[model samples]
Target: MTSKVYANAVAALFDLRDGISLMSGGFGLCGIPENSIQEIRRQGIKNIHAISNNIGNSGRGLAWLLKQKQISAATCSYVGGNPDLEEQMLAGEVQVTLVPQGTFSERIRAAGMGIRGFYTPAGYGTLVAEGKEERVFDVPCILELPLGADFAIIKAERGDRFGNLWFKETARNFSPLMAMAARVTIVEVEQLVELGEIEPENVHVPGVFVQRIYQGVDYENAIEIPMYAEQ
Candidate 1:
């Protein structure tokens, strides 16, 4: 096969469908594919369902897309910073499914592993348990379902042209897992190097999971951090 396109990295991210599910990797504005999210916003794609740790703070990360009314539903663990999201939820403009932090991570991991599904005790008798199959194994558990996406937008600290990726610190959380679960994974990295530059052992995501990779430029360093801290 020929090499993939490299220019205009954001072009790799536009799905444009009304009901496509998207997995975005980030945690409270950390490790987010800001460039891809901005492109999605600029593309004006509607009715996107996002699976992520948080909705991202206002004007940053996925919040940029949420601000544009591009997201229709969110399966997230936390969404405290965006009032628009809260208002939308109250008015039924958006659907929100809150997942526990641990359960959320496991869902993405399970999808990556191709294990079909697994069980967990995270939501046993709450609303999360409603309408879901229940089974008692060695321990009390609810049958957790697999989670994958039509597309996954991930940010890496560094990536090789061949698509091997490395993430920094806590930023590594969901990016690698989401990379595997999506039909098409687009990775935006702060630094892009030629193949063989990154050590094989340090690669968090293999090229097989990533269909598109690009070098993003001019990422705003001050992303949604507290005002008390200097930018």
Candidate 2:
């Protein structure tokens, strides 16, 4: 078969349509596919349903897209730092679903594992349980369904032409799970290596899950909340 590598993020995402469901891998600004997100901006695609740990802060990372009104709905754990996201939410311009950190992780995992839905007590008595089926095992547990997407755009520290990827430190947060949970997974890596450069054991995501891979440029790992000394 031919290689899975693409020339650029634009080519990798050529078939992407508006109103598509998407999963972007990251926690805050770490491990975000900034190049791909920029390409999304350049392409001017709108009305996206986004799933991630957070949508980034201010005018960077996913917040850049959110600021452009590209995102229609977001399902994520944290939305504190991005003022644009909060403003949109308050104005009823965007639909937002706040999931617990652990519940968010499990829902993505359940999709990848082909499970329909699982019960958890995380939000049993709160607003999360409203209208959802509940069963009493030891305590009341609400059914949390799986989440999937049409495409998953992820960033990696390094990868091979065959699509195997490896991420660094905290950057590895949601990339692997997003890779597994999407219909087409596209990865943007800092370094694109030969087929055997990355050993079998070191590979976080196998090529089978990733349909396309590309070398990204100018990665700005911006901190969402920068802490500075008092002046």
Candidate 3:
């Protein structure tokens, strides 16, 4: 059997270059591939277009890219916790495409499914409709295009040598869809198990969608919004 494991995040992201579109699988900091994001930072690759649920929180996660000036454009639903990202967007330094949360998810899903576009009423009559195609079915709808990436960086709780992955809790949010939507999918896992260790039914993303896999390091599960237990 061919092994999909890499020595490190740098090696796994060997084919990465400047000015490429990337899909980052995470909802805030929850399921992010922290190692690969750090590798991208260390390599100083610039002019990236990142697609994700959010631009990260504070100075961690994807915010590191924004801080490094590596990301030129961002396609995401939220950026409230990332001051650097908000600053860049407001300063016209980075191009921002803010899609409604549900619509954004569906757009990425459409790419993986090989669908050209779909109609949604999420942005029917607002600024989102300014220069896009619009039609009415039962209600007004806007044509949303599919969102694909050159590569996808995802995180899983467990992965096998051949690339099958299993995510934990809400960490499963955007990963499986992004895995299928990208041309190349790289996964960072906490545990690397032998092949067939994971049962067939529990595999979140099949090995077919993943090109490379590596065990991650120095994971910091940063809480975006901190709420202590009534202390």
Candidate 4:
């Protein structure tokens, strides 16, 4: 078998081009592919259709791309704390599609599973139902199509040369789903281990879904909101 490892984020994302739909795996600032995102900024790839949760908060993560005006469209569940996205969205700079969180996850999952579409009551009878097919079962339901991307950028706590991955705690959020849905999945890990080092039972995402893997460097891993217990 061929090696799936890359020297760095630039090598992993060498074929990435402008005006492509991109899925970024993260929840707020956690589990984001920091190195890959920085490389995309450096590459100055523009007109990107970005899909992620929150995009980024506090001017970090995907917010860097938004700051560069690289992203032209965004599909996400939340944007409350992301001022960059909010400003762009309100100024008619970036087209924003806000999906219900549950619906968003299902849409991505559907694409990975090869499902064409599914019906859900998530946004029935609201703006979300407009211009879409609606049906009444026990309750009103609206049709949602699968969401797929040309490429996905993911981060993991540990990965092997074969591309097997393991994520930590809440950081595991959307990485696996995005990996499965994208045509090519690029992953950066803090720890690069040998094959079988992670153990079969602990692999969060199987190697088959990932196309490229690299050991990352200089991770800030900034927390969005730091909470402290009162003494």
Candidate 5:
């Protein structure tokens, strides 16, 4: 089998360009592809359509792109703690689409599953349902279309040359789903192991969904909100 490993994020994202729909896998500041985000900044790719959970929080993760004004639009579930995204949205610098957290995950999952659309009651009879197709089946539900992207950037705890991945704890949030939903999935792993190193049953996302893999360096892994007990 041909190895999917790349030298670094730049090499992995060689085809990345401006105005592409990009999916970033992470929840808040955890499990983000730090290297890839930095490279995108360095490369100065602009007018991006971003898809993620929080779009990063506390001025990290995807917030870096927001700081650079690279992202022109975003589809995400939450934006509370992300001041950069909030400022851009309020200033009309970025187009923001806020979906309910559950609906957001299902939309991405539905894309990967090849489902055209699905109906859910998560966003009904409110701003979310406005103008969207609605139906009544025991309860009112709004139609949500699949959310896919041209490329997806994700991080894994461990991955192999063929791109099989293993994520750590809450970090596993949206990476797998984004991997399956994107046309090309670029993954950065802290540990790049040989094939079969990860147990068959332990693989969270199969190599088939990933196109490129690299061993990352200098991860910040910042805590979004630090807490201490009576310290």
Candidate 6:
């Protein structure tokens, strides 16, 4: 129902406050909310905790937040590529909580389902098991805690004013799951169309899960990462 359009990135993210939890939906560079990420850096929101798969490369993606010293902690699966993030973690400026990839995905699913926790054996007998209650399953196992976020930033290939979303191939990435697990989900889309343009079966994220929708500008063609050969 709120079909307004914003002129720039700053206007879109002007309401973000310091120390809030954010769930950024992307795998590396795919499906990242580039414009909103830039706005967050420009706004200088500090002490933020991000739930994401991997921090983006230097000078791009969520790495911009680390470069700007805007993050206080990160709950992520991988954090090796960004040197500033590693340095900050080592210097005690940033806290890092590493979760197994499968468990991490399940936690977000649990959050969306309104479940408190789920059972997982991924981190048993390791540092991840510490401070968690244990219960016997087939032999002996315990469930880890569910994870959720106060806010989520995701990208969609196309979205309508009513908030129905569609995604492009790999860009479908984490956008769907992250949309449901957050208190507020903001969507950045390659195209913004009028309501009823998208087919019902084509909608990946329904309007109920999204709080904001903005048309992204300057979406470049696929970025080539030099570290690995293209798939």
Q: Root-mean-square deviation of each candidate, in angstroms?
A: 2.4, 2.0, 1.3, 0.9, 1.1, 2.4
| lDDT of each residue in 127-176, candidate 3, tens digit only | 88778899999999999999999999999999998889999999999999
Model 6, residue 165: what's the lDDT?
94
lDDT of 1 by residue, 1-231 (tens): 545436655566645467889999988788888888888878888999989888767757777877788889999987688676777778888899999889898888888889888888888888888888888887668888788899998889998877899988888888999999988888999888888788888878888888888888778755565567566
* TM-score-sorted candidate list, best first: 4, 5, 3, 2, 1, 6
TM-score of each: 0.92, 0.95, 0.96, 0.98, 0.97, 0.90
What's the true lDDT of residue 20 in model 6?
A: 95
Candidate 6 local Cα displacement, residue 191, angstroms: 0.4
lDDT of 6 at 49: 97
Candidate 3 regions exceeding 4 Å error are none
Per-residue lDDT for 81 in model 3?
A: 79
lDDT computed for candidate 4: 0.94
Model 4 spans with C-alpha error above 4 angstroms: none
In model 1, the clashing pairs are none
Against the correct fold, how does model 1 do in TM-score? Answer: 0.92
**Cα deviation in Å at residue 166, candidate 6?**
1.3
Query: Candidate 4 — which pairs collide?
Result: none
Candidate closer to the true structure by lDDT (higher is better), 3 or 4? 4
Evaluation by TM-score, superior candidate among 2 and 4: 4
Model 2, 1-231: lDDT tens digits are: 877889998889999889999999988887899999999988889999999888766667888888889999999988887788899999999899999988898898889889999999999889878989999899889999999899999999999988899899999998898899999999999999988888999998888888999999988887766799999
Q: Report the lDDT of model 4 for residue 139.
A: 89
lDDT value, residue 130 of candidate 6: 84
**Lowest lDDT 10-residue stretch of candidate 2:** 53-62
Q: Which of the predicted structures, 1 or 3, would earn the higher lDDT when compared with the native?
A: 3
Whole-model Cα lDDT per candidate? 0.83, 0.89, 0.91, 0.94, 0.94, 0.82
